[model samples]
Target: MSTPSQLSTNADLRILQRNMAAALMQPLTRHDGLQSRTQVDFITPNDRLSGFQRLEIYARQYWFRLLDCLYDDYPALRVLLGEMRFHKLCRDYLAAHPSTSWTLRNLGSQLSAFITEPKARDVARVEWAQTLAFDEPQKKTLHIDDLLGADPSALRLGLQPCVIALRIDHAVDHFITAMKKTDADVRSGASQAMSQAPTRAAIIKAPRLKKEVLHLVIHRHENTLYFKRLTREAFLMLTALRDGLTLADAVELALAEADPTTDWPVQIRDWFAEWSQLGWFCKPSPQP
Candidate 1:
């Protein structure tokens, strides 16, 4: 460990390692550092594939597995592109985008942008949304009783992870909505007409369990992302509260949205009932 020569050798080795990695990354072309010493080992006459071949297997496997994860996550995008074209897309993507993510989950975070290129925008819009829908968080649900005298001071709201907030343009939103409404009609011999009007429907935030269409915050009771949609007003109220608004203030905001004439107390009661039923709020029962 104290040898200066060894230290110098290590620095040289690191430089060489970087160069070697770069060469392997690029197509079979020459690079400065990899000039005459192109490969680590030369292929012997009898040996068909060299040591580099054996080493490359690992690199190939890494790319394949990561790409496979992307495919599994973005099947809709793949379908839109078709098999051969999808393969080309993956090829072009991998070479240009190298694996920059620490986890495969993060791998496709930018895939939406990747597919949003001029040629791929149409399908990218669909695929990116799907990917986000799949990865959104799931939180523990707060039962109905938790919404009493909801004081923001000591209250902590547990939000469902699967709850997505999408602000889509009218055209894409409408296209998606129309697709959903026509699933049954499509099979029933109804003629299809297409129009660009934005409709917002929750994608499959929850994978299994009896409930599937998202309109609310998504939670995982045991295994699936179950959603309980909140009315727009209620959602806004919670948003304010979650961001540190006092219970009284949040209630004021909520009551204002309900109806100018509706009694605030009554509105709060009714809203609490729904919030509790949806398991959207959790109150800490034990006092300090």
Candidate 2:
């Protein structure tokens, strides 16, 4: 319906917008100059600043905001890598995997896989899982009574949306707990108290973390996120249930990997009781 001149204008506007977006994401030079691909005339020069200078301000601010989001999201990684190295890593990561989502919530979603350091990767995985646990919705808690008439042989269950099961090779949860407590103290202005807490510094300076296998359930309860440690048997059972196996089948899978001497029948009963009280189960969603 548009005339030739109007169509040309619309095309020009799209080009301008695309160029501006690219300019905003461009890496700045060491002197803070704009290394932009956008045409100089795209922005008007003001009395106090040139057009490129104005664009540079926007580019720097845009990058800084994204950098800040990652810095906050990956605090443990920041502490482990030190400020300089962490900042470098952030820049490198952003360059490789620029923001694609409108919400910054997903900015660090791929960070765990992007990181190559074993310890740092584990820490990132835990932190990211905690982030998901805190942000994801919690469903109605399936109480034990709801299953009173359910057949044991064919019973299937779903975990709460906020629940995440992880098997990692380091005590990253403990390390994260220490980091969180220290951060809380610093935020509360308890400087002297934090100074006396040796856990933060001790863990940071240790040459290598003692490797410990952990099977953990990260979940949210009453708006608070927590890491619940689980035995390998229980973790496997929960994982199988989460993957749509029948409760009987899930139990069999757990027992397969369980210790021969352990009384798993009793242990599984106790686990279900405890998990039910903690509100971990939900009605499985019907698959299309």
Candidate 3:
């Protein structure tokens, strides 16, 4: 319906809009803004701002918005790294892996791999799992009665959608708990006096994190996420079940790896009962 000139003009406008959007998504800089301005010839200068300056505003906002989303997703990581380092981490991560999803909730999905420090990466992994568990689709939880009539040896249990098993080198769960407590104290009036005291020079000292393997099960219940510490044997057992191992095999593996001095059979029985009551497992899949 349009003339050739009008069609050509419309095509040019589309190209310019795409170029401006791509520029805005990149990290903002004077050089980048100047390069981006060259692609769009139609932007007009206002009394208060030049055309490039206006474009720069959008560029800055784009970065800030994504940065804020990353910050919110990994608050404990920010606390561990401090403000400046965390900002640098976020900037470098964004540069390496830009958001590709429509939702900001997925902004930090690749953060664990992007982080260089092992401890920071572990924390990111745990936080990412928490996010995933929170958003996981709801499924019916399995109860003790569901397994009462079945042969325990042949049952292949399924884990709840909200369950996540992680093994990390540091006690990140404890660190997260401490950081959350500190934040809560600051938010309340309890820490007002301490906050008002004279500030000491910021010392860049790394906290002495214990270097030991920690097995953890993070799950959501009653709309709250709980971190449950587990022994190596128990963790292995759960992971085996999660990977579709038969109940007999998972139990045998866990018992074999358990401490000789401990009453593993009793311990496992209690653990299974407790976990089942807590809705950690889903309905067992049909026997093959």
Candidate 4:
């Protein structure tokens, strides 16, 4: 029960809203700024501001809000790249992968793949894994006593849902820990100096980071996330189990690549006991 003119006005408003949203998401540059102003018509200019200028305000704020979200999600990456470069990176990343989810937590979900630098990509991978581990569902954990009595050949094990294993070229874990410490120190200093006049404090240098092959296990326990360094053999065994191999087969595969002189049986038994106690294994399913 609408007139043709009213229906037409509604359609025009919808199109304008869509165009404005699209323009706001683009990079706020001179070229894009002019393009956006030309594409959308605005109300008559008042003494205070022009239509384009008003749109520019909203556009700039939108971009800055997205940049802040990326900064919060990847603080270490931001530190590594410095402020200006991090800002550019966030802009580029957002242009490529716009937010598709209702929640902003998934903003950096594709960051590791989007990053070009190898070291940055490695760090992003670790950070992403930590994010995933933090959100993974809680499950009943296996106990040491359960493994101690099971037959090695017949046993089938499952890793905890919160466990994530990564093999990387750089020792990113050490770098992340160092960066966190630096952040903590800076925050502490700021808190202490709030009442006093600002003074030049000695700058704390970040630890020298080096590239070295590393295998890591990221997992969650009691709502806290942790990173555990693993030996090559241990990584292989755990990966095998994660891939659905029987315990005996996984142990054999691990030993095949391990040092021949080492006492593998004792080593594996100790490793299993430690892992079991840490609740790295998933609880067995109830019998049908």
lDDT of each: 0.48, 0.76, 0.73, 0.72
1 or 4, greater by lDDT: 4
lDDT (tens digit, per residue) of candidate 2 on 1-288: 111223257776777677777777777565545785555566779899989888777777777677767866777787778876777888788888899987777889999899998888888898788778876877888988888887767899999888999999888878777665332111111212111101123225523444799998888887778889999989999999888888989988888866799888889879999899989999888755
Clashing pairs in 2: none
Residue 123 Cα positional deviation in candidate 1, in Å, after optimal superposition: 8.0
Model 2 TM-score? 0.85
TM-score of each: 0.52, 0.85, 0.79, 0.77
What TM-score number comes out for model 3? 0.79
Please tell me which model should have the higher TM-score, number 2 or number 3.
Answer: 2
**lDDT (Cα, tens digit) per residue for candidate 3, span 1-288:** 111223358776676667777667666553334344343334568999877777666666667667767766777787778877887898789878888987777889999988879988998998888887776755788887787777767788898878899999988888777655221111111211121211223534445556678998888877678889998888989998988888889988777756789888788888889899878898655557
Best by TM-score: 2
Per-residue alpha-carbon lDDT of candidate 4 for residues 167-239, written as tens digits (9 for 90 to 100): 9888888887887622211111121212221222233354555799999998887777788999999999998
Q: Rank the candidates by TM-score, best first.
A: 2, 3, 4, 1
The 10-residue segment of model 1 with minimum total lDDT is 181-190
Candidate 4 residue-wise lDDT at 200 = 26
Off by over 4 Å in 2: 1-10, 31-33, 36-38, 181-208
Residue 86, candidate 1: C-alpha displacement in angstroms: 4.2
* Worst window of 10 by summed lDDT in candidate 3: 183-192
